[model samples]
Target: MSADQKHFSPPARLLHWLMAPLVVAMLFIGVGMVATLSSWHQTLLAIHKPLGIAILGLVSVRFIVRLTHRTPPLPNDMPRWQQHIAHLSHWVFYALLFAMPLVGWSMLSAGGFPIHLFGPVNLPPIVPQDVQLYALLRSAHTVLALLLFATFLAHLGAALFHGLIRRDGVFSSMAKGRD
Candidate 1:
């Protein structure tokens, strides 16, 4: 209800939403690439691998900016429990964002698959093929993706909870920055 609070810095706002589409897109592409195995497999991998790497790079920059820049504090009126949930959810997002790509890369590498980025660049493989480990990592990575989706829903619920019930600008702080 007050007009005195500051909004997120422009860069933080930009990256916040900018990363959303990429994450969702990567999740879909990743699933497609994993579910199919045939002539088209390599083609999909070519597209998916680079895109995942690119997302990882951008998230890295966003994390740095988030740490170094000034983010508007939670509206003072928000409950302490809500603030704690927000903080925990944010860290969870960061972890999943980072883990998904790394695990994918490791899974592929462990399968003796080549990682071809957008062009000539090749990502270094983390391990040699081990049938058992590849299966294990693939399962873990899939579970993490599902967790990301769940956390994402929780994040949305909180945002709506704030923007509607609380009549606060918490959602707007990030949403106001148009992609």
Candidate 2:
């Protein structure tokens, strides 16, 4: 591939850098939400719900951008297994991006709770209310959140490996738009 093709498109990089911190904050916020019984719980819930919806929307757009554009290729010298792992990890990130909010929304729906985004703009429930369903979805959402956090750490480690250790362009492909 040409040098240009070896770098991620501008939009892709923008979405990536934009989402990274938001996702990290969301993870920490999630932990706080579950850890506290104080008044802060409601505060965190308010932030968590809206932020999750935002992530879902952004990820949907990001997925479209990804599909429409060609991504930078993995290094030729990289092991085949590593390449496969890299690809799988990306798909997993996409899956978690899409899954986390939907599950949260569905969990709320199952519990018959309102997803208040702002005044008069609440999200309508997608599932009928059921205590059993609520329990199941709540558990699923927690598990998915944990998985997303793990994947995020692995991705960050890989990027550091390529950038700091290997001195490869893989990290720069996403970190910088050009050579």
Candidate 3:
């Protein structure tokens, strides 16, 4: 493969694809958790907590993989501003990926809620419970979730721009390896 066309390592690609749907689902679940007053609220909460934790774990590994590996470079013909935006957006994504789950977890901790990962797999609280603290963390979590969704949309738009308009390999680099 050409250097610019080099695909992400399999593991990185796997993590990227895996996290995409998961993050989307978590966003929807968060909305559902807040919107519903029925028994389904608890049901959504059950899914949201564990999923956030899972995202946390996967993002940790993804961060490490990102640090240790080399990603394919953007097309040389792309504008410098676009390249800068691409790099900045990537870091923003990484930050959001790490921050969203943490804020959610801490929000629960501050509210004295158990972060039950699964059947009997409860994570310990990172902060002591306080109503005031819970309010702040909960607000932060909601704002960050909104920010994450915006970033996701921007990333998707860029991917489509590259894949469709530019016909560049940028999208395909993560989509698949050179054929």
Candidate 4:
């Protein structure tokens, strides 16, 4: 693709869309996990913890790939405010992507729980078990997840508004492999 033509590198595009659904699932599960009781709740916790770590792994790989690949710039005529918002939102997404998993892992580690990544291999706990700390991190994890969900909605709304109303290629840029 020409430098002037807005487009996503194939890997970036794939990773972007792939993570969208996973992150949404993680957020839903995070919320749902809290409301349940008994074996069902435990099952969701098992899935939520590991799945979140998986998303973190994917986000790390995506970030590295994005760094290695250059994305075309926003349309030259795009307004400064819109451009600023887009940039800020993207960074916030990354921040949450990095923070949520780390907090969860830290919480587990501090709580003296192993991180089981859907495999027999067990991850050693990071922090020594402490009830007070565990409670604090647990709350932090949930709150951050909620914040991330809201930011994600705002991001999606902006993309749709830009793509459908502004008729800009902002949304298309992430999935141009089909377009």
Superior by TM-score: candidate 3 or candidate 4: 3
| Candidate 1 local lDDT, 40-100, one digit each (tens) | 7777777778878887888898899879876667888878997898999999998998888
The segments of candidate 3 whose C-alpha lies over 4 angstroms from its true place after superposition are 1-5
Worst 10 residues of 1 by lDDT: 1-10
Ranking of models by TM-score: 2, 3, 4, 1
How well is each residue in 1-179 modelled by candidate 3, as lDDT tens digits?
46533888888999999999999999899889889899999999999988998999999999999998889888899999999999999999999999998888899999999889888799999999999999999999989999999999999999999999998888999998656
For model 4, residues 49-72, the per-residue Cα lDDT tens digits are 878878989999998987888776
Angstrom error of the Cα, residue 175, model 4: value is: 1.7
State TM-scores per candidate: 0.86, 0.98, 0.96, 0.91
Clashes of 3: 0
Tell me the spans in candidate 4 whose CA falls farther than 4 Å from its real position.
Answer: 1-4
Tell me model 4's lDDT, rounded to 2 decimals: 0.84
Error of 1 at 45 (Å): 3.2
Model 2 C-alpha lDDT per residue in residues 15-129, reported as the tens digit of each score: 9999999999999999999999999999999999999999999999999999999998898999999999999999999999999999999999999999999778899999999
**Which has the greatest TM-score?**
2
Cα RMSD to native, each candidate? 3.1, 0.7, 1.3, 1.9
Compute the lDDT of residue 40 as modeled in candidate 1: 77
